[model samples]
Every structure is written in structure tokens, then in C-alpha cells.
Target: MSNHTALSTQLQHTGIIDAAKAQQLQTAASPWWLQILLGIAAWIASVLIIGSFLGPLLALADNNPVRTVAAVALLAAAIWLTTRKQEFLQQMAVAIALAGQGLLVYVIYDVSGSNDETARYACAVIAILLLLSPLNQLHQRASLSIALLCLLSLVSSAPLLAVVSSLLAIVAALLWCSRLKWAGFAQAATIKSLLEVITLAALALTLFGQCLLWLDTGYWLDNRLDMARALYSALGSVLLISTVFWLSRLATVPSRLALLTIAVVLCILLYPASGLLVSTALMLACFYGCSRNWYALCLLSMLLAISQFYYSLELNLLHKSGILALSGVTLLAAWLLLQRYQRRLV
Candidate 1:
């Protein structure tokens, strides 16, 4: 057969050049400008409807109806936009969901009897939104979950709301685990999903710690140091486990560096003071492992050092003799490690 005939046959076998269906799919997908206009129209309609109808009705019931109505309206508009523009839905959904979350936080602050209650409800809403929105459909699951969690937290007593929020968190965790199991870690999408899950979990834990602090300042002070240490340890363990799994699947140097960067950041955030030592050591090790690449380690190390320095200054340790001695030793060790790696690379 001629080259042209052979190429045509191969294209048909691979299903890349479908002359009939490609044109139809392209036509069916809405243009970018049209999608934008539709989203704007939906947002306007939601605002008007909620402001004119829902706001007044809620106000009559002695609620801060204006803010509530606005939050609901924005959330509705986001759902509508997601439905009409599924192609670009992920990016748009995050923005709209965040706006909705902001509105909810404002409403919680304005309506709550105490700042502690407001904070608890705000954290709960944020955790639920982060857990639900990215994995499931915006309209079906995320909107429903947000609405339910908001009502439970804002309208219920503190004790009951805390229970409800904790339950919801457990549910979200289970669902996240199931998704991870089904979509194996080898997939790129799975990596993104796992990162989101870890972020939400970390935020939830921090908020839980804040709640403990708010309930009893004395108790918080007595236990916070230990709690911080434990939290950082847990975070470190998670990073080590995830790194092993990721390294097996990822062979490329850049991908490994990316994973290491994420692990380093998590360590810093989870335990800024103590994490400084670990993160510094990890970065140096990463640099050595990656063949003494200065460019790769520079940014990660600088971020960890800055955060550690800020935390140290905050704790009034800058003038302490012991801290200064420790800092000097740490720097010397890091420099030595760098030199050793540099020589090996040469």
C-alpha cells in the first residue's frame, strides 16, 4: 500500500482522526465568550432573586437576612455556572466557592453571640467546602454539603454544632480515602486529589487546635506546646510515607523535586520552630540526592529559614545564648553538607 493509505489506516486504528464526530463535539462545546456571558447573567439573576425575595423573608424571621441571602445567591450562581460550563468548571468553581465561603464567614461573624462560636463555624464551613467541592459535582454534592454544614454550625448550639461538624469531617475523610484507593497513586489526577485532601486535613487540625485554645486559654497554654510537637510529628510521618509512594511511581528528577518541595512546605507549616531543623536537613539531603543542584534547594531552604527566623523572633529567642549557638551549629552543618555534595558532583 502507498504511504498515504497506510497512514490513514493507522489513524483509524488509533481513533485520533474521526472525521464525523470531531466536528460535532467541537460545535457542541460552547465558546469561551458565550460561557462567560451566561455565567454573568446567572450571577445577576441570583443576586436579584435572593435580595428581593429571600432577604426580606429571612429578615422578617429576625435573622441577618441580607448577608445570608447574598451568600446563598452567590453560591447558587456558582452552581449554575458550573453546570453550563463544565469544561472550565474546576477553575471557576474554586473561585466561586471561595466567595461563597467568605460570605458565610462574614455572616457567622456578624450573627454569632461570641467570637469563639463564629470561629468554630467558619472553620467547619471551610473544611467542608474544601473536602467536598473538588471531588464531587459542584451542584449536586458541594452546594448541598455547604448548605447543610452552614445551617448545622450557625443555627445549632456550640456543643451540638461541634459534634455535627466532627461527624461531617469523618465522612469527608472516608470518601477521600475511597477515592484514593479507587484512583491509584500512579495517576496524576490522584496526586492532585491527595494534595488537596492533605491540605484540608491540615487546616481542619489547626482549626481544631484553635477551638481548644478558645475554650480555655489556660488549658491551651498548658498543652499547646505538646500538641504542636505531636502535630508536627504526625505531619512528618505522613510526608515520609507519601514520598516513598510517590518516588516509586515518579522516576523523573523534576517530579521528585516537586514532591520533595511539597513535603518540605508541609513540614514547615506543621511545625515552624522545630520543623526548621528537619526541613533544613531535608533540603540539604534533597540537594545532595539530586546531585547538588543549588537552584532547586535555594528556594525551599530560604522559605524554611525565613519562617523559622520569624517564629524564633516572635518567641523572644533571638537574644538567647542557646538559640544563637544552635543556629550557628545548624548553619555550619548545612554548609558542610553542601560542600561535600558539591565535591562529589565535581
Candidate 2:
């Protein structure tokens, strides 16, 4: 949402589309179960096999000199091997990097509490490693995902700092995507890759973390975990406003009266979905898609957002129906108004 206005206003001023051309999509891959099998194996090893087991086995020693040195050396070796290989060992590189990050995290958790007593400082160091990933392969993307996971892991413990850093990272990603001029080396792949990681992290947290409980329960709201949801919603509301203005007024009457009417209807959406982290994620994804002219993303985001609303346990059927009706009508009116504006311009 921070970057949405900049791009949207630019698009309106210039009759150009820095967008992907339309083409039918197709996919071909090996058995889905096999792919899942490999992924599960890799993830388990990263989180348990080498990550937890070997990390603790080494930490049993009284000192970290050997363990730290070995971790660094292994990471260096993995990067070297990954870059040197002619064949893309994407899985191998990703697994090794994950293992390294987990080991560093473990060291920070175990030793930092006793020494400097600043575990967060070690977390920051690990974050830097993920950001400065040495492998010039797809492993870089995996590093971004791990980095996002690290951020999410810190959210409940350090709500303000983690949310601020995640916001800054998303802003940086948008700026990078904007710089990828047509036919650039990586095009928008880097931007998309970065966003994908962030999106998945947000989804995971909202779906499985304290976010669900926060949304589904209102008995207690004084915890730090709830702080994360509030912060996210506050930021996401900016995009919601921007989008409402763009669709209903900017391209229409552009008058105070028109703006007032639109805001009144948009209020319906605010109360029902504002506090939920998943709702924020959906809207942010929608705004991101609209800003970047990613049609497929927009459609997918819309469906996900709708489904989330339909499946919400926080609101009863009657309230859900009201919210859905209001949302649907608001969008319908905005769409009709936008179509009219387009016709007038034509």
C-alpha cells in the first residue's frame, strides 16, 4: 500500500502498461507426491535431522568455538559447491543454507542468553546472513523465505520492531521491482520472488500463529501477539483507503460529495475485516497486484480474500452475510463507476 499510490498515479498519468502480456498458462511437472516427498525430506532435515539433532549434538560441548567455525565453514562450502555446479542443485543448496541458519539460531538462543544476554542481536546477525546469501542461484530466493520466517518468528516477542522491519522489507522489494525496466536481466522475477516469500510467511503466521486466536477471540486483547495484528491492520487500512478512492472517486466525480459517499460505503468493509491478520494479508496482496498490473495475482487474491471471509469463525452467519453483501455491493459500485469513467475517457 505504501507504494501503491505512486504506481497507480503514474499509470493514470501515462497511458502505458508496464505489465506482463497476456498468455495462456501451462504447467508440467513430475508426480506431485514425489515433489512433496522431496520437499518434506528437505524441510524435516532443515528443522530436525541436521538442524536440531546435529546442532544440539555439537552444542553439548562446553564451548562454541568448534561449532561456530564448523557452521561457518559448511555454509561457505555449500555456497561454493552450489555456484560451481553446472547442474542446478537448488534443493541441496537450500537445504544446506537452512541448516546453517538453524545452527546459528540455535547458538544465539543457547549462548547469547548467558553471555551478552542479547539474543535478538544474534537473531539480527542471522537475518543479515540470509539477506547476504552468497549463492547466486535459486537458493537466494530460499534465503529470502527463511529471512521472512525469521521476521515472523520475532513478531510476537518484538512486535513493534518486527512489524517495522517487515514493512521496510516490503517497501524495499516494491522499489526494486519498480527499477526492473522491461527485459531486464531478471525482469520482475526478483520482486515476485521476494513478495512470494513475504506472502507465504504472512499466510503461515496468520493461519497457524496467535493471529487466528486473536481474531477468533475477543476476551483478551492486551498481549503483544495482538499488537502484531493491530499494526498490520493499521498499515493495510491505508491501502484499503487508497483503493477505494482510486476506484470510486479519482476516476469518477473527483468531488467532495463523491468522496463522502464512497467512504460511507467503504466503512462497511473496515469494521468486519480490519482486525484480522489474514484479511490484511488478502487486501495487501490485492493492492500489490493492482499496483503492479498483475492480473492473475489480483484474481487469485480476490478469491482468497473472499474465501477467507466465508470461512471466518469470528463472525456468525448473519454478520458474515452483512459483511459479504456490503463488500460485494461496494465493489460492484466501484466497478460500474470505473467502467463509466473509462467509457467517458474513450
Candidate 3:
């Protein structure tokens, strides 16, 4: 063949191969329904195996070799099914669901006098792995659902494990949601889902701490207080980290407003009087810096008003000091709004 003809033929073959590969890639990515079905199947298999083995092992440790063997067999089958899928959605959903159910089973067994540290550690590791899996929207949603279920299960069976798992799940969900490149309702839905996880986790931790306190004993009280303090510290750290991340995601005005609101609430909930004053000052500074936006100025004014009212009712602050702070915030807000209106008219 002529050299020119040979080069042309080679190029044609390369193009054909590339086209075929592209088609194959598209085909490999299955529909969301199929992925969801596969995930459900894997979850069912995992539950059957883990539940059979764990329940028998916990309740009848000596006489249930059959249940234990069956559980192992089922888990192996589920793992095999999960490994067969290379698609992001299928693999992630199946793996996360399986891992979540497995963790639930392990917690049940551990709390039932088995007291297996190894099992608990394994569950934690698996849960983390599931959270870290590469998945599309369907898989991420499945993973979030599974994680929430696991959180609820652990709450009743193992409070400490529940807290750790829930926190990790919340962080993972938020990270995953932030990476999603969706628009409109889809994006809003993902953010709402993540916020729900956070809210649930916070409520769970609070309830768990309160329950411990109600159990009654000096030792229990001391431990409960320590746990509450630890929880508050952890929440403060999360809020700080979240604020920093969100500042990058949010508009300037909304970012400042959110940070100010969060700081005020955190100070009231977690800090003493001195910390409250410091946080209030910080919020005032943030508001002042971002007062160009009317919405931000309005939010700041409302916050200041509430804070002043609460402070007056709760503390014997000098009347002049209270008056000065309130007056400053009011004047600043009025000036900002007037400037904004004038600019808009111009």
C-alpha cells in the first residue's frame, strides 16, 4: 500500500475504535432504576446473612453454627454481586447499602453481650468506606439513606457508635453534595438532604446526653456533662469549618450573615458570658463590614435587637451600654438601607 493510503487507513481504524469505546462507556452506565434495584437486592442479602448469624451468635452462642455459616454465605453473595458492577452508581449504592446493614447487624450483636471490639471497629471501617465510594446522584442518595438508617439503629443500640457514624455520615453527605454539579431543584434537594442529616444527628446527640443524665448518679452526671461539653466543642468546630467552606460557596452578603447568625447561636449555646460578648462583638464587626446589602443589614438589625432584649432581661447590664449598642446597630442599618435605595434609584 502507498504510505499515504496506509496512514489514512490507520487513522480511520483509530476513529472507529474510539467511537466504539464511547458507545461502550455509555452502555455500561445503566439507568437509575436498575441501580436502585441492585442496591435493594444487596441490602436484603446482607440483612439476611448478618441478621441470621449475629442474632444466633448473640442469643445462642454455642448452638447456632448453622446460622453463622448461613450469614457468612449470604454476605459473600452480596459482596460478589457488588463487585460484579463497575458502573459508579450500581457499585456505590450496593456497597453502601450492604455496609450499612452490616454495621447495623454488628451493633446489635455487640450490644447483646457479645462485646466484640473487633466487630465494632470493622463496622466503622466499612461505613467509612461506603461513604467514600464514588457514586452518582442515585448512589449518593442511597448511601445517605443507608447512613441515616444506620444512625438510627446505632442510637438505640450503641449511642457512642451512633454518634461517630452519624457525624461521619453528615460530613460525607455534605462533601458529596457540595461536589454535585446540578442546578435548581436538584441542587436545593441535595442541600436540604444534607441539612436534614445534620439536624437529626444533633438531635440524637442531645437526646442521648439528656437520657444519660436522667439515668441518675454522680458518676453518670459527670460523664454526661463531659459528653455534652465534648459534643458542644465538636459542634463549634463543625460550624467553623462549615462556615469557611460555605463562604466559598455563598455570596458575600449571605456568607457574612450566615456566619454572624451561627456565631451568635453558638456563643449562646456553648459559651459563658465573656465568650458571648466576644462572639457578639465579632458578629457586629462582620455585620458592619457587610452592611452594603440591605438583606444583610436587616438580618443584623434583627439579631442585634433580639440579643439586646435577651441581655436586658437576663443580665443587669448598664442601661447606657445597652442603649448604645442597640442605637449603633439601628443607625447603621438605617444608613445602609438609605444608601442602597438611593443607589437603586440612581
Q: After the best TM-score superposition of candidate 2, give how far the Cα of residue 253 lies from its true spot, in angstroms.
A: 5.7
lDDT-based ranking, best first?
2, 1, 3
Error of 3 at 274 (Å): 18
Measured with C-alpha atoms, the lDDT of residue 319 in candidate 3 is 56
- Model 1 collision count: 0
lDDT of each: 0.47, 0.52, 0.45
Per-residue lDDT tens digits of candidate 3, residues 248-316? 354356445544554454444433222122223323333433423422433443354444444544445
Best model per lDDT:
2
Cα distance off (Å), candidate 2, residue 231? 5.3
Decoy 2 TM-score against native: 0.60
In the order shown, the candidates' Cα RMSDs to the true structure are 10.9, 9.3, 12.8
Q: Report the Cα lDDT for residue 253, model 1.
A: 53
Model 2 misplaced regions, further than 4 Å: 1-63, 85-88, 113-124, 157-192, 202-234, 243-264, 275-316
Error of 3 at 8 (Å): 30
Query: What value does the lDDT take at residue 85 in candidate 2?
Result: 35
Q: Could you tell me every candidate's TM-score relative to the true structure?
A: 0.39, 0.60, 0.38
How far residue 205's Cα lies from its native spot in candidate 1, in Å, is: 6.5
